[model samples]
Target: MSLLEQLNQDMKQAMKNKEKDKLAVIRMVKAALQNEAIKSSHAELSNEEELTVLSRELKQRKDSLLEFKNADRLDLVEKTQAEIDILVDYMPEQLSEEEVSEIVKQTILDVNATSKADMGKVMGALMPKVKGKADGSLVNKLVLQQLS
Candidate 1:
């Protein structure tokens, strides 16, 4: 089944099981996907567009988790993290650090990125390949580390 189809199935199961946290996260994802379809005036979103929206939602949760942690609110941190976990079930499995490093190295070569000045070139070429599998800030840091 497509990711969206799987998400829909899971949403129904969550409701049947009375899984409040899981249901909440699933509802948020459903709303986001619906919003995207409406915004683009498309009858259905492409797989790439679905992945993009999923990644953005996951990223937002990660940011909130970090903020909650920094504020020493363990309760919110745990809650936000649970939501992140639920969202991740719909994402492609993440690439390992070694795989990410290897790709970043090749991207730098392909883009002829010599310094931080060429960071944009490297990132532009890399993000498409890395999207939904790698953290953007981590990728940016690795690119800068390589360029420097």
Candidate 2:
């Protein structure tokens, strides 16, 4: 099923199960996706567009999780973590660190990226292949490691 369809089904299930946290997160993400669709010229988002929205949402939660932890806000941290967990359920299967590294290495080669200066070239050619499959920070780290 498409992500939107799956989200709709899960939202119904969450409501039936009385899973408040899950339902809230699903609704929030659904709204975000819909807003992105409206922002663009099209009314329906393509798979890539949906993935982009998903990635942005996940990244926002991860950033908040870090900030919450750093501030020693245990309660907020827990809530944010639960939200993250819920969002993750809708994400694509993640690529492993080794797998991402290998792809980064190949991307470097494909772009002829020999040094840090060529990082942009490497990443430009790489993000499309790895988007929604791996963490951005992990990919950036691997690309830097490979180039320098």
Candidate 3:
């Protein structure tokens, strides 16, 4: 099933099980997806578009998680972390650090990226291959390590 279909099925199950947190997350994600679709003037989103929306949602929650942590707000931190956990369930399986590093190494070579000057070239060619699968900062770190 597509992401939307899977979300619908899980939403129904969450309701049946009285899982309020899970249900709420699912509904929120659904609304985000629908909103994105409407913005793009499409009735249905392609897989790439859905992934973009999911990533945006996940990133927002993660940023919130970081701010909450910095402000020492344990309550908000925990709440944001829980929301992040729910968002992750719908994301593609994350690429391991090792796996991402290997891909970074290969991409660097493929693009002939020899120094930090080529960071843009390497990343432009790399992000499409790893988008939604690996963390951006991790990818940037790996690429910088390889380049420098």
Candidate 4:
């Protein structure tokens, strides 16, 4: 099933099971997906698009968690982190740093990226292949390290 369909099914199950935390997170995800669909003229989102949405949501949660901790709001931090956990359930398995480095190394060579000036070329070649499976910042860092 598509990610959105799976989310809808899970949302119903969450409601039936009285899983408030799971239900709330699922609802938030559905809303974001729906918003994206509407914005994109009702086209169904590709898996890549779905991953993009989830990544954005996860990042927001992580940012909020940090802010909450800084403000000594453990309650909010816990809540936001729970939401992040739920969102992460649907993401592709993250690649290890070593695996990412291997791919980055190959990409750099593939694109003939010899210097900092070729960063864009390397990143453009790498991001699509690693999308959803690796963190963008991490991949960028590896690519830079290899180039340097």
Candidate 5:
């Protein structure tokens, strides 16, 4: 099933199961998907577009989780982590750091990226290949390490 359909089904299940946390996260994802569709004037989003929205939501949760941890807000940290876990179930399987490093190495070779100056060129080519599979900051760090 398409992501949206799966989400709808899961939302219904969550409601029936009385899974308050899961239901809330699923609703937030749906709202984000709807907002994205409205912004682009599309009747429906492609799976790739939907994945992008999911990734963004997951990233937001991770950032919030970090902040909550720093502030010692254990309750919020636990809640944010639960949301992250829920969102992760819908994302593509993440790439390992080793796999990402290999791709970045190959990309640098493909682009003949000799120095940090070509970072942009390397990143432009790499992001599409790794989108939804790897986190951007991790990829960026790998690229910088490979280039330098």
Candidate 6:
């Protein structure tokens, strides 16, 4: 099933199961997807577009988790972590750091990137290959490490 269809089915199941937290997250994702469609003037989002939305949601949750941790708010941290877990369920399987490093290394070769000056070139060529599979920040770090 497509991600949107799966989300709709899960939303119903959440309501039936009285899973308040899960239901809320599902609704939020649905809203984001709908908003994206409206913004792009598209009737429906492709799976790739849905994945982009999912990744954005996941990034937001992770940022919140970090802030909560810094504030020593255990309750908020736990809740944010739960939200992150829910978002992750819909994401494509993430690449390991080693796998990302390998791809970055190859992309560097493909783009003939040398030194930190070519970071942009490397990233431009690499992001599409790794999108939805690896986090951008992680890829950036790997690229920097490989280039330096």
What TM-score do all the candidates reach, one by one?
0.95, 0.98, 0.96, 0.94, 0.98, 0.98
Q: TM-score of predicted model 6?
A: 0.98
Off by over 4 Å in 6: none
Encode model 4's per-residue lDDT on 55-134: one tens digit a residue: 88888888899999999998998889888888888988999999999999998889888999999999999999998888
Taking the tens digit of each residue's C-alpha lDDT, what string does model 6 give over 1-148? 9999999999999999999999999999999999999999999999889999999999999999999999999999999999999999999899999999999999999989889999999998999899899999999999999999
lDDT string, candidate 1, 62-132, tens digits? 99998998999999999999999888889998988889999999999998888899988999999999988
Between the candidate structures 1 and 2, which one is better when assessed by TM-score?
Answer: 2
Top-lDDT structure, candidate number: 5
The number of clashing residue pairs in model 3 is: 0
Could you report the Cα RMSD, in angstroms, for every candidate shown? Answer: 1.0, 0.7, 0.9, 1.2, 0.6, 0.7
Candidate 4 achieves a global lDDT of 0.90
lDDT head-to-head 3 vs 4, winner = 3
> Candidate 3 — which residues are off by over 4 angstroms?
none
- The alpha-carbon deviation from the true structure for residue 145 of candidate 2, after best TM-score superposition, in angstroms, is 0.7
Model 4, residue 122: C-alpha shift (Å)? 0.9
- Model 3 scores a C-alpha lDDT of 0.94
Please state the error at residue 99 of candidate 6 in Å: 0.6
